[model samples]
Target: MYSLLGVRKKQIAKMLFYENMTMGLIALVLGIAIGSLFSTLSTELLLNLMGIPMDIHFEIPMNAVINTSIVFSVIILYTSLQGFRLIYRFKLIELFRAEKQGEKAPKNSPILAILGLSMVILGYYFAYNFIDYVEKINFLMLALLILISTVGGTYILFHFFTVFLLRHMRNNKNSFYNGMNVISTSQLLYRIKGNATSLATISTLAAVTICSIGISVSLYSNIEDMTKGVYPYSYTHTVIDANKEAQVDATLEKHKSKHQISHDYLLKTLEVKGTAHENTIKINKTELNENTTITVISQSTFKDFAKEFNYNNVKLNKEETVALTSELSIKIKKQFGDLQESNNTKVTMSDGQNLYTYKIKEEFPYPTKNLFSDTFIVSDEQYEHLKTTSKEEITRIINVENESDSKSLTADLKTIIDNKEMPLYDYYTPYQQGIEGSGMMIFVGAFLGLVFLLAMDQSFILNNYPRQTKINLITQSYIKSELQIKK
Candidate 1:
């Protein structure tokens, strides 16, 4: 309304208020009816196609509907009223000459462009390098640096760098003299300089929309596979004593009768006092801890497990051991050098009276989901010595015959263990964990993706609306004047 009839704030306000409110009301009614019908049809069709059971009912949430209607109505009324303030702020003379006023081209600054480029490079360096230590560093400062550099750099690129490059292009006589090239380049230079902020805003929104959607979709798609990597077992139960072990075995046997149990095994771990030293040319490191927990498995058992995963079978001498570490530890080791060259760590185990030194032969993927500590695969003799010397902990690993029975079997076994008054450390199945973790990732990713897309679309519209209107008005006025001259 203000664009059509300038210098009349009171009249514009009344007209916009009455006319916009009436139109908004009509739109609201039609929108609600059409929206509800489409929503119901889509929901019913999707649910039926997916073979999912749902109670389909035409239920209107009056509270939500009324609240939304009220909010939009208030927004329209407020916007119409607020729009009048823009007219009042403008001088009466400027309003009268608004159509005659033309936008001036902005001056380009080479120095500002250089500074912005430097800032962009510095910000990228910080983002790429310090990302690993983001937890240790001041996150807010880092974020501010990135934000400032991106916004400032984008503005400078649009305002000055673009013009500078185009001017260089214009200097080439062959390109500049081409039909419409000179005029188009000159107009683009002016447009870019004048609308630098808007261009930057649109570019940033586009980047954000792409990144958000891309990352969200990737995470949502790969959640299941990633979860499997972290948790490879169907279920694990820690048992301390023989009685509890027997109870668990009995429970497994009972389940086996119902064909719910496929296979199971026992894993033994021992806590020992040890000092480990890494002897290497790149880095010589020593770790002395009294309560280092080491997983003790026989060579035969390790070989059998290796065969299951197609890992190279490792044979450890009586005085040698192999270390199995988490994925994070493996990454750290790779950062130093080749695993074989960098993983020559000597572990000295003590039984308070005697000490045994074992050379680490190799490293392997962690046998279980215990991520907090390191695991060692030792020979049968070494395992016996460690078990007799120190306290030992045992865990029962169970696999279900059917994937669908995992949840129910885990629940039943947990109940049996609980009823026996056994001290249960933890009970989990991979199926349950995978579903929960993946479901959360999908939910969060989808929510954030939708929000970013909506925000990007809204920002694009809001930023371009006024510029488009101005351009249209200028073109219309120019055409009308040309027609009048021709007549």
Candidate 2:
């Protein structure tokens, strides 16, 4: 019609391009305004969730603004060019008949639909046995397979299976013509092919959102457990000097109100370098040959610790041993199928001139912190023999009433031990760090989830617009024809 009216092709293209660009500019302005307005509030919310004690000031970076402007400007320009191309490529006849000749129903095969279902099932099977696969060298390949199967299957299901199902329903005259089923079935059949990509995309985004939020919440909820696994004692450190040890005790006594001591015990252990192995294969290190430091604790001291901390008591024979390992190391080992129930494991320790080997009967979960890598519990007789030849270290372990809340006490103790040989390990550091890390994850997950949800909603609206318009036009045409036939 425009061409018949002597309107140039370039002129029509310019008009369409300007209209789209105007809308794009308006949306860009609104998006930037809303983002800037909520930036400070979002930051504050994130900080509070992470339990960080701090203040935040609001400010926008010029670089961010410039980058956003440049990116959006390019998008607007590219989309505007598409509008120009549409004007040039579109025929007036096709535009007029668009409502009459709606989207044709797409063809699909049963074999492809079945294949899609199988792939999805295969993906789920892999995910169900993920832990077992993690122990294998081909874990990365398994992960990639999972991604491909699930993502590809979902697209295929939406594109082919959905169309086939809708067409099958339409073939049933009784069902297709029942109530509003005629309109619903017809619309789905015609629109499924065109909207398949958007539907699949929405599903993938929803899964990502759910997974991110779930994992983040799980990590945040287990903060206390995680902290305990790494730093069991409220405060544990090697205090060599009697004067400094007395000063630490005095400080703890002075702050009794804030840091009530639940239990305070001194641990005397012999430190030695040794090789630990499971059967014939070396298991301690990745290199498997490096000497690792071992902390040797007597059975009597371990029993006392168990009684004080409510841990399960164990009795070890003279040659039998109980090994204590950190939670993270245990997890990594378990993933590699290294940590297992065995009666053949052994630990060989050496003091300058003598070497002592003990067979491991069990492995116990213990927080070694930074003072040592591994601790071994042996009989009183064996401990005495090892102590005679090895250097001994004294460590003071203190447990408070409220460990996480003792930040002030931790700071005070740090000052007292500063510039000294005593190495301090406190629960407060891990507790604070856990909150910060988990809280950051939760914030990021929630933010991305919200963004994906909004994008999904917009996709639905955009994908449905043309279909709905065509459906309404076709319905109007049918009513007019029916009235004409009746007259």
Q: Quick one: best TM-score, which candidate?
A: 2
The parts of candidate 1 lying over 4 Å away from their true place are 1-9, 23-63, 91-93, 114-151, 170-174, 240-262, 275-277, 280-290, 304-311, 317-319, 327-329, 332-344, 366-373, 401-406, 416-487
lDDT of each: 0.63, 0.80
For 153-179, candidate 2 gives per-residue lDDT tens digits of 989989888877887899899999875
Q: How many backbone clashes can be found in candidate 1? A: 0
Per-residue lDDT for 473 in model 2? 92
The global Cα lDDT (0 to 1) of model 2 is: 0.80
**Consecutive 10-residue window with the lowest summed lDDT within model 2:** 282-291
- Which pairs of residues clash in candidate 2, taking residues 3 or more apart in a chain or in different chains? none
